[model samples]
Target chain A: MDMKEFKLNYYEKLYLARHFEDELMKLFADNKVVGWIHSNKGHEVIGVSLALAMKSHDYIVPHHRDRPAYLAKGLSAKSLLAEIMGKTTGCCGGIGGELHIMDVETRIYGPTGVLGSNLPIALGIAYANKLAGNDHVVVCNFGEGGSNRGSFHEVLNMAALWSLPIVFVCENNKFVEFTPMQKHMNIEDVARRASGYDIEGIIADAFNPMETYETFKYAIEKARRGDGPTLVEAKTYRLDGHYEGDPMKYRDEEEKKYWLERDPIIGFKASLLNESIANESELESLEASVHQVLKEAVEFALKSEPLKVSDTFKNVYA
Target chain B: MTKINFRWAITHALDEELARDDKVFLVGQDVGESGGVFGLTRGLYEKYGGWRVKDTPISEEGITGLAVGAGMIGHRPVVEIMYMDFISLAIEQLANQAAKTFYVSGGKIKVPMVVRTLAGGGFKAGIHHSQSLESWFTHIPGLKVVYPSTPYDVKGLLKSSIRDDNPVVFIEHKGLFSLKGEVPDEEYTIPLGKADIKREGSDVTIISYGKSVHQSLEAAEALAEEGICAEVIDLRTLVPLDKETILKSVEKTNRAMVVYEATKESGFGAEVSSIISEELIYDLDAPVRRIAGAFTPIPLGDAEDAHFPTVEEIIKVAKEMCY
Candidate 1:
């Protein structure tokens, strides 16, 4: 967990997630990848940094925009690509497509399609851990828009009142779908709402992986120490449109340019070079390796067979 | 054999399962110190403590979602929805999450959980507290729907539900809570999808479950006094329905009647009647009849009695086929 190693790991995962989304966008345009694609282009650093702070056995109930989180949890890129391609070799055997990618073996509870639905599930998993006399924490990820859901309030209250070992991470990327945060709610920060639940609310610079990692690490440790849940709000922006095919008419030019200038990957790379942590050549090699990994993932997914129609009825029961 | 009330039979099943497996735990509103709204989980919190018999917030959706997650992690969680009507709040968790988790996970996960709720309208608890919604869970795949009538059936079916590897919706009639029935003292379990023959006859067959089974049995007795033998088949489980027992009874009697406490429109009895007509069309001597609750909201007071099918109505339906 040295700075050099952490920098490399963060850059590698971010590159993988970025390239994965890029490839998915291409495939989606060609109609090779089915279903709606929620790109994690700008939110990668936030998801990956938080994921890195979690233990292997600890549960991660991910939001739909959690490609980097899955990569950080060590799920095979080929399996995720295969899932997007609706292949039998996918993580869920192609039963759940882009919206639902789950791996029980990795303790990644998968992404919930419904807004804020996984919060209670994550709280329950933490409850189970507490009941079993374990200190394992559960991390529940959702967007700023999902914070308005009743489940958000219900789960937070339960988790706080019971002193459950869990962390609620809200990736506040400004806009929720097509609606901006201001239009959705009057509050400037979603974390401020956590005070009502009697939990500490903290905000982090989502574009900075180091900041997100350190913040989530503290929150996760506090949870594992039986200190109850903490609400961490990461201020970031969605680099791309809400979905792959979203029209860009709703967003203005200046707002988009402001976020693009502070793009996490470019900023992190500049920091790595300026701090003399990694030379330009080393960063180039890391980027090349990530490209190779994603190329092979796409190849594996393309070569995998699509699930048969008969497979639909296979797991309907035990 | 020992005689116990229906509620105790359920409590005994919970106690046994909690003792049998360390992973089994109960979560619901008022299930701990208050012993549940209906006292169904009485004495459980005292024996197992608060950790096992947990009292949760009045959030059905939250509790159900929590149980689904715990079940995915190899814990058998039995969630109690205070009333069957409130299950509407938890349909997303139960139908979308719990019922689809196993299938959507591609067999990677199993949601071994039970949602215990009370149905029927005999107590006059009004619209919110009393409603027969067993058909809702029966319609969902990846979920087992169990509605037992007698204390013996409730004990056995509940044990089977806890051991089941899929999510099970166990519906107990509110009116049948204090009904007494003979249960075996020794350890035993009745398999799901198996129908129980409460009474045997030959003239006609009456298929029902839950509180309706009692009415059907009483109607059969009345029919027997009039020299018209009506066989009664209590369908223990609805989803994994025992079509074999139902069809066999219909084939022998050549007359079938489906009884239920829910509305007639798209009720569970319609499924039974359809099955009888589809599979045993040639075995019937008369058109299959369904005696169900009136297609309206269950009203309060004595008006609720008119909403549910009475023993007299069952006897009349049986006589219509007998003549």
Candidate 2:
């Protein structure tokens, strides 16, 4: 928990995530990606920082918006981009696009389209880990909308009662689509809801990469040591609309400006500068390098062979 | 071979799976101390304890989703839906998420789980509680649907379903829970796609399954008194249907009568009739006859008896074909 290297790695990963989201924005505008796309643009620190803290054996069930967390955990950009193209070469083939990309090998499962469904599933995965003597944790990610779904209560009740080893990362981005959290239900912090389940709850600044990492580390360490589930609410913002094409006319101009000013990527960069841990030249060089990875990923995705229509019969069994 | 009720056969399957592998576990509304609604999972909680035999919340969607997710990690989860009618609430999770997980992952993950529930209208539980919707599940390509009628089929097929790497919908009929039949004590499995022949004859082929299999047997017995021979074929698993056996029987008899307890309109019997007409069209002597429940909500209490096809109705249809 006290390791400084882990904090540095988290910051670096979040930087990569921010760049990935930025590239995806251009791709969406160009129509290079098909179907709908959700972004982790404003919440990069929470997504990448948490993934950086998780052990290889630990599993992650990320909602649709956590692209950085998924790619950071293990999924290759080529496969992820191929999926965006709806090509057979994509991970999970063309059937699962942006919202459903998953790498089962690394346990970064479910870029689940359905909001709250992953809560129980993540709890179940953690239950499996506990039974198998894995001592590994399951990191669950969901946005503010998920807090209202029935799955949230069912999973929380069971997870608390069973003492399952899970860390619920509720990224309170303040809005469910266009509806503000205040409109959905009356609660100051989503993390406080966990007190009803008799479990520990903590709130952290989603834009602060260091705080997000520390909060995730506490939950994961508690799970690894068999202290039961923890609810960690990362207060973040959604820089984009619910979907790529949404007009988002419901929001006031000022509300949009508030989130844009507090963009986690910029906040983290400022922190690195204030700490003198990273130089401006070093940051530019790292951005340049990550851009190359994305460029090669795009090329790899384009050059990749299309899945044949006849190949559909393969991979059902075994 | 052990003479076991359908309930005990299912219990035996669960007991066997739990004893053999540590990863296999069960959960449902009343599976634990309640011993399951129909007692299929009787004494499981006391035997395996809470970790394996879990009692879950009333949210069927959550139950199924968790089972699917847990299965991905490496657990063989057998979740029970209290009644087949309630499956409608969880179809989104079961059909979209669990059924398509493997194909969506391009073979990287597997949803190795079983959803067991009781279907059919014999209980006369009315429109809300009574339904035989296994055909709804069979429409999907990724899922494997099993409708087991006999104790032997229940024990064998459920064991195979739990061990299989894909999701399986194991539909049991509530009326057949107490029905006893000979089941082998030895561990065995009936392959997914194979069918069973309950009776042999040359006059006509009676294709039925689950609760309808018994109704077919009753109709066959009535036909025997009138000196007509009918071949009774019980399709234990509907998804990986034993079409080969049904077709072979239809070829010999040159006539087929498909029976089911579901609605007569576009019921599974209609699917069997289509399969027969498609495969053995030239060999047919008479048009394939289907006897099924009346196209109405299953009536409350015993009043549904008229809507539910009786042995007389089956015999009436069979005699019409015989002449």
Candidate 3:
């Protein structure tokens, strides 16, 4: 795609994610959603770029903050919204809710609530691909706080040791739940931990979609070439609270303002306009299109059937 | 039929399954080139080569999660956690990931994986190596817990577990590894959730599994000498427990005694006792008696003898229930 078209496409994804979260918050307030929705409002570019760069066969094991990744990976907003609303039409038939929504058809492995548990599970998918002689790679995403988990360390060493085709993407939004990055770990960069396993580590400014996309492309291609795993730390911020209802007492106003100024969507929008990649009319049209899509998604989710009691007991065994 | 040791029975099952299905692979610490710490996976590594019979680093959680992940995408992975005690390190993956994936995914993914681990007190392997922690897995739904006793049951059950489309926790008794029993020359597989009547009697039913099954059989023999007819039931599979066989035996015998190698509190035997009393309480002539290990952590080597339930203890429980 040309630079103009690429920027427009990136802008569309960013707006869709921002609007998705914005509408989701309203739904939560209206009590239409079940469980917590870890909003990926600011870090949209990190997951969206990775999804954009990923191939059809490549698997993505995304975390709670990666709802945008699912959208970018081609999961319909209708299915995703229905999943969050506990409707039968959801991705996992409403069994996984928002926290654990997964669609095997999209090659999307859902996350476990147990912090970094998906790292090793994603490694398994990569391992299976390698054994099958498939060049497909798995992009396993986690937060900086999740990097402190033993699953992170153990999975990295095993992936490197076996030379599995996998990429570990760390979205360093600083806070791990209520704890800050510095308080949780002494290291500033999660990618630096990759050196312990003798793997390549790269850092990218996730606020810039071009940089995030290029970084993921390099790491993903390197993994597909069977050179082993790479840790790509996407530097970003949690524009919203950790969860929907998290109190903002832990974060200072100045720090919040600093991250807010660099919010990826705003930065990308300014760049698109300043560079003349897209006109004001074009950007407004894209925003209107995203709003229309989300409106339909909400209607579809609201119209879908609610989950029955038998649904809970249906899949206990194969 | 040919008589073989329990360890070789397991090896034969793995070998046959690895040869029978291309999707079947073994990955665990020292399982490949090293032939496993117990030499159970010895010849298979040389036979199937490194890819199928792969060895792993000493990361129980990693390998267990690997098996679960691999199984989720159609690979039949049999991961061994050298000792059941080390399973504590991987319980999060086993219980949370492996056990729940099929259900959470609404049956779209089938985790056809087997976690084979050695558990029992006779190995003198200290608290970390010697533990009958089957009840911990039995408590988790979506996981099939199998504790086989005889060589025949091990070979058949291991083969069946590999073929099953769910996560199976196959716990082998370390004490029974050297014990020999007749296994058929022809290919055979014993289905899960089926209890075998090792010895039949009308007076009392002795419910047991794993190493305790052997003790229960011995106890039944002694009970026969003492004029107390005790029926010995070997619960080959613990999760999809053979409730029919247990209930039928207790109903016919009218008295039940549960014997197990695990601790007395909340052991798998307790589940069996509850099932018997819940379903066939009116048929039972006497209250169910439980003979199990001491509540303490398994002691070192020979000291495990005192902690583990002995044949005399089973006999005592059986006599108490029967008389």
Candidate 4:
């Protein structure tokens, strides 16, 4: 895709995610939505860009804050909203709420709430792919704090040793559910720890869709070619609190302002205009279309019926 | 028919499964070149290449999660945790991820994997190596727990566990690995959740599994010499418990005695006693008795015998229940 087209598509994804979460926050406040939601507001580029680079058959194991990644991997916004609404039309038939959204058809394994739990699962998927003689790559996304989990180290070592087709993306959004990055780890970059497993590690600017796309594209391609796993640490910030209604007192206003000013959506818009990649009208049209899509998704979710009590015991076994 | 030890029975089961289905593979520490620490997976590594029989690093959590993941996506991965005590490291993967995947995903996915781990305390491998943790897995709703006593049961049940569509925790008693029994050369499979009556009598019913089954049988024989007929029922699977067999035996014998290697408090034996009491309370001639290990960590080799339930203890318990 050309730069203009890529920029336009990236802007649409960012707008859609931003708008979807904004609608969800409203639904949560009015008691329409039941469970807690981890907004994917600031880290839209990280999930969308990486997801855009993946094939339909390739697996994407997402963290809680990865609705954008699911959308990028072809999950219908209506289905995502319905899932959060605990409706029967949801991807998992309302069995898995927001934290456990899964679409097997799209090969999206999970959006696990457990901090680094998906890493090893992703390794297994990649291992299965290799054993089946398939070149499908598995992408596992987690937060910076999740990198400290034993699963991270153990899975990386296995991936490196076995040369499994997988990519480990750490969305280092600075805070780990209220704890600052400094307090959590001594290192400045989680990517640096990847070398301990004898794998290549790269740092990318998550706020920049172009940079994230290019970095993850390279890693994904390398994995598909049987070169093993890569740990890509995307530097981003969580614009909101850890979850809806989280006090978020640990971060200062100045820090929040610093990141808000460099909002990925705004930054990408300026880049598109300044670089003469897209005109103002083109960007505006894309933003309008995204808003319309989100509006329809909300409507679809509202019309969907909640799961019945009779079906509660349906999914407990095969 | 052929006579084989419990360890070789397990090996033969794995070999048959791996040869029968290309998707079935083994992954665990020391399972490849070393053929497992117990030699249970001996020779299968050479028969099927490294791909089918893999030697993983000592990462129980990682290996368990990997097995769950692979199981979900069309591969049947049989992971060995070496010792059941170390299952603590992989509980999150087993209890949370693997167990919940099928249920949480609304049945869109199924984790068809078997976690084969060595349990029991005769080796005196200390607290870290020796434990009877079958109760822990049985408590989890989405897991299938299997504990086999003899070579015939191990071969048949292991094969059935591999082919099962749900996540199964297959526990092998380390002490019983060398115990031999007659196994049919023809293919056979013992379905999970079925109880086997090794010996049937009419006085007191002794319900047990794993190594405790052998102990119960010995106790039953001793009781028979004294004209206190004892029926021994081996509950091969704990999760899908054979409640019918247990209740029937309790009703017929008018007495029930629970035996197990795990601690007395909240052991699997407690579940059996509870089920019998709850359903067949009026049929019992006396309150159910239990013969179980002491409520303490398994000590070193010298003190291990004192910790586990002895055959003599089972006999004593059966006599009390019968009288």
- Output the lDDT of residue A186, model 4: 94
Candidate 4 deviates by what RMSD? 1.2
Q: Can you list the residue pairs that collide in candidate 2?
A: A92-B104
Per-model CA lDDT versus the true structure: 0.90, 0.83, 0.89, 0.90
Place model 3 in a CAPRI quality band. Answer: medium
Clashes of each: 0, 1, 1, 0
What C-alpha lDDT, on a 0 to 100 scale, does residue A288 get in candidate 3?
91
Error of 4 at B166 (Å): 1.0
The complex in candidate 1 yields a DockQ of 0.77
Clashing residue pairs found in predicted model 1? none
Per residue, candidate 4 scores C-alpha lDDT tens digits across B137-220 of 888989999999999999999999999989999999999988989999999999899999999999998999999999899988
Whole-model lDDT, candidate 2?
0.83
Writing each residue's lDDT as its tens digit, candidate 2 over B165-198 gives 9889999888898999998767798888788899
The residue-by-residue lDDT of candidate 2 on A15-108, one tens digit each, is 7777777777788888777787777777777768777788887888988778788777877777788887777778777667788787766777
Model 3, which residues run further than 4 Å from truth? none
Model 1 stretches astray by more than 4 angstroms: none
- Per-model TM-score on C-alpha atoms: 0.98, 0.95, 0.98, 0.98
Which candidate number maximizes DockQ?
4
Instruction: List, residue by residue over B1-323, the lDDT tens digit for candidate 3.
Output: 99999999999999999999998999898998989888999988889988888888888898888888888889999999989999998899889988888777766877899999988877687888888899999999999999999999999999999999999999998889899989999999999999999999999988889888888888788889999998899989988988999888888889998888889899887888888888888888889888898999888878879988888877777777766
Model 3 residue A121 CA deviation (Å) reads: 0.3
The lowest-lDDT stretch of 10 consecutive residues in candidate 3 chain B is B314-323
Screening candidate 3 with a backbone cut-off below 3 angstroms (N, C-alpha, C), the clashing residue pairs are: B124-B301
